[model samples]
Target: MDFRFSPSDDAFRRDARAWLDAHPPAEATPRQWERTLGADGWIGLGWGRTPYGNRTATLTQQVVWAEEYARTPHTPPRLGHIGENLLAPTLLAHGTAAQKDQFLPPIARGEAIWCQGYSEPGAGSDLAAIRTTATRTTATRTTATRTPSARTTSPRTPATYRVTGQKIWTSHAHEADWCFVLARTEAGSHRHHGLSLLLVPMDQPDGSVEVRPIRQLTGTSEFNEVFFDGARAHPDHVVGGEGNGWRVAMDLLAAERGVSTLAQQIGFGEELERVLEEARDTADPLLRDRLVRQWAELRTMRWNALRTLGGGPDPAAPSVAKLLWGGWHQRLGELAMAVRGVAATAGPYDWTESEPYELDAAQRLFLFSRADTIYGGSDEIQRTIIAERVLGLPREARGQ
Candidate 1:
C-alpha cells in the first residue's frame, strides 16, 4: 500500500478542519455536545459523505478525518459508542430507505439516541445463546418475558421464547430512544442460525419497557439492565433477512474493531503522553524501562491502526492492532499506577497530594484497562481468529 494521502484527501482534511473552526460545538455539557454533534450530522462523516458512505473514499481521507477529529479539543463532540461505533455502520449497510430516513438523520443530527441490547445475563461472551424471543404477531412483534429470570440452559431450536430473560450491561439504556436488540425469531436449530436483529424503540407512551441503570465502580451509571415485558416490535423492524442477522452482526463487529481511524488513536495516544510526562519525574530505573516499553507499544499500535483505516482492507491487521492496543493500554495503566507509589488506593483524583493527575489517571486507567482485552472481543479470541483465518492454521475445536 502506498499509504500516502492523495491530493483530494489533503483537501478534504483542510475542509474538515475549517468546518470545525467555524462551527465548533457550543454546548457546555458533554451530553449536549453529543446531541449537537448528532444534530449537525458530524458524528459519522462516513455515513454523511457520499463517496465515503459508498466506500469510495481513499483510505487517506478516512485516516485524515480520524486524526483530525481526535486532535481537535473542546470543539468536536464525544458521542457515545452507539452513535460513533455500532448504529451508524448498521444503518449505512442494511437499513431500508424508511429505516435509514428515520434513523440516520437523528443519529447524524444527534436527535434520536440509541443503546445496545447485545449482552444478556447468561449470553454475554457467548451471544448466540440469547433467549430473548420475538414472536411474530399480527399487530406487532410481541415479546413474552422481560424480567431478570435465573439463567436457563441454552435451548435447542427454541420456539416462542417469550423473552423473560434480562439484558445486563446495556449502555445508556435509560436515555436512549431506541435499542438495537438481538433476539431469537426462529424455532429449532441451534448456533447462530435462528437469531434475528431488531431495532426496538425504548420510550413509549404506555411504559412497556423498564430500564435500570447499572452503576460502575467509579459511581457512574454508564450501563443498565433493560427489562422488556411483553414488549412488541413491528414485523418490519427486523434488520436483514431471517437467519442472516448473525452475518450482519459479524460485519458490524469487524467494522467496530477495524475502523480505529487515526483520530481515535490520537485521543488514545493522549493518555500515553500523560503517562510519559509523569514518568519523567520517577527515579526508579526498572519503572523507566517499563515506561519506555509502553511508549513503544503505543506508537506501534497507532501505526497499525492507521494502516487498517488508511491502508484499505487488510483483514489480518485489525485483530493484531486491537491486541496490541489493548495490551499496551493495560501496561501503560500499570506504569501510571507504579508512579503513584503508595497513594494508588485513593478513591478520587484529588486524594493524592503528589502527582495528582498522574495518580487519578492511574486509578482510571487501572479500573478501565481490565476491559480492554475483553470488550471488542477477548484477546485470546482475536489471536485464535488471526491464527485460523489469517494465518491459515488448523481449526481448533470450539469447546477445547
Candidate 2:
C-alpha cells in the first residue's frame, strides 16, 4: 500500500490546522469543548447519513482531521462523546427510526454525555456470563433520559423493564447522562443468549441509581462503580431488539477498532517524546538503547494499525492491538521512572501533614499504566483469543 498522503489530503490538513489555530478552544472544559465544537460543526464530521455528521468527509479526510486534531497544542477534551463515536455508530447501524431521531441530534449538538455499563465483578471480556438483569414489569411512570445529551419528551408510553445490578470500572458514569447497558432479559439464561442492550438513564429522578468514583493509584477518579436499583428503561429504549444484545455489544467493540486509533497514536507519540526529553540529560548508556527501541516499536505499531484499519472484525485484531499498546505503554511507564532516577520514588507531600503522596506526570503515568495490561482485556485473554481464533488452535478446556 502507498504510505503517503495525497496532495488533496495535504491541503485539507493545512485548512484544518489553520482553523484550529485561530479558534483555540483546546483548553476549554469538557462541556465548553462540546458546545464549541458543536457550534462550529466539528463534533461528528465523517459519520454517514446522520444529519449530525458530514458524510461527504472521506475516510482519508477523517484520518487527516484526527491527526491534526490530536496534534493541537491543547485540543478540546472529548467531553461525553461516547454518544458520537461509540454509541452513535452502533445506533446508526441498529437503532429504530425513533431511536435515531431521539438520540442522534443531542449527540450531534454535543449537548449530552454517555458511558458504558458492560464490566462487572463477574464479567469483563467474558461478557456472556453477565448477571445484570432487566426484568419485564408493568408499565410504571419513571423518570427517563433518552440520550446523555437530551431530555425525553412528555410521557407517551410506559416503562418496560426494571434494571437491578452493579457495574464496576465504569468510566465517567458519574457524569454521563445515559448508559448503554447489556443485561440478561431472560431469567436462567447462560452465555450469549437472551440478552438485551438497553439505553438506561443515569440521572433517574427516583434515586434508583448510584455512582461512586473509583480512586486509582494516580490519586484520580475517572472510573466509577455504578448501582442500578430498580431503575427503569422505557420500552422504546431497547436497542437492536430484545434478544440480540450480545451481537449489538460485539458490534460496538468492533467499532472500537477504527480511525480513532490513528489519533491515539499521536498522543502516544507525545508521551514518548516527553520520555526522550527527560532521558536526554541522563549519562546512562543503557537508557539510550531502550529509548531507541521504543521509537522503532512505535513506528511499527503505527504501520500495523494503518494496515488493519477498516478491515472486517477478524476476532484477533482487537486482541493484537490491545496486547501491543498495553505492554508498550507499561514499558514506557517503567522507562519514565528510570529517567527520573532516585527522584521517581518520592511523592509531593510530607507524611505528617494533613495530605500526603502526590505525584507528578511521570509518576502518575507509571502508576496508571500498571493496569494497562489488565483493563479492556488482559494479555492472557488476548493470547487465548489469538491461539484459539487467529491460529485455529483447539480451544482450552474450562477449569484447567
Give the per-residue lDDT of model 2 (tens digit) for 83-196: 778888898889999998898877877887899999898887677778899998766465667887888855645547899999999987988999999999998888888999
lDDT, candidate 1, equals 0.69
Residue-level lDDT for 245 in candidate 1: 71
**Model 2: how far is 37 from its true place, Å?**
1.1
Task: Identify the leading candidate in terms of lDDT.
Answer: 2
Q: Which ten residues in a row have the lowest lDDT in candidate 2?
A: 49-58
lDDT of each: 0.69, 0.84
- Tell me how many clashing residue pairs each candidate has: 11, 1
Off by over 4 Å in 1: 2-7, 24-26, 29-31, 38-41, 48-58, 75-77, 139-164, 347-359, 392-400
The residue-by-residue lDDT of candidate 1 on 1-400, one tens digit each, is 4656778888988976886777666545656776655554456655546322223344566667667777777654354557556877886787776776666666655566788888888777667677787766543334454458754444333232233347888877887888888887786646687887778888656566899987665545667999887666656667786667787777677767655535656766788788788777778899888877877876777666665665556667767877887787777777778887777776455554663433355687777877778766678878887999989999776531
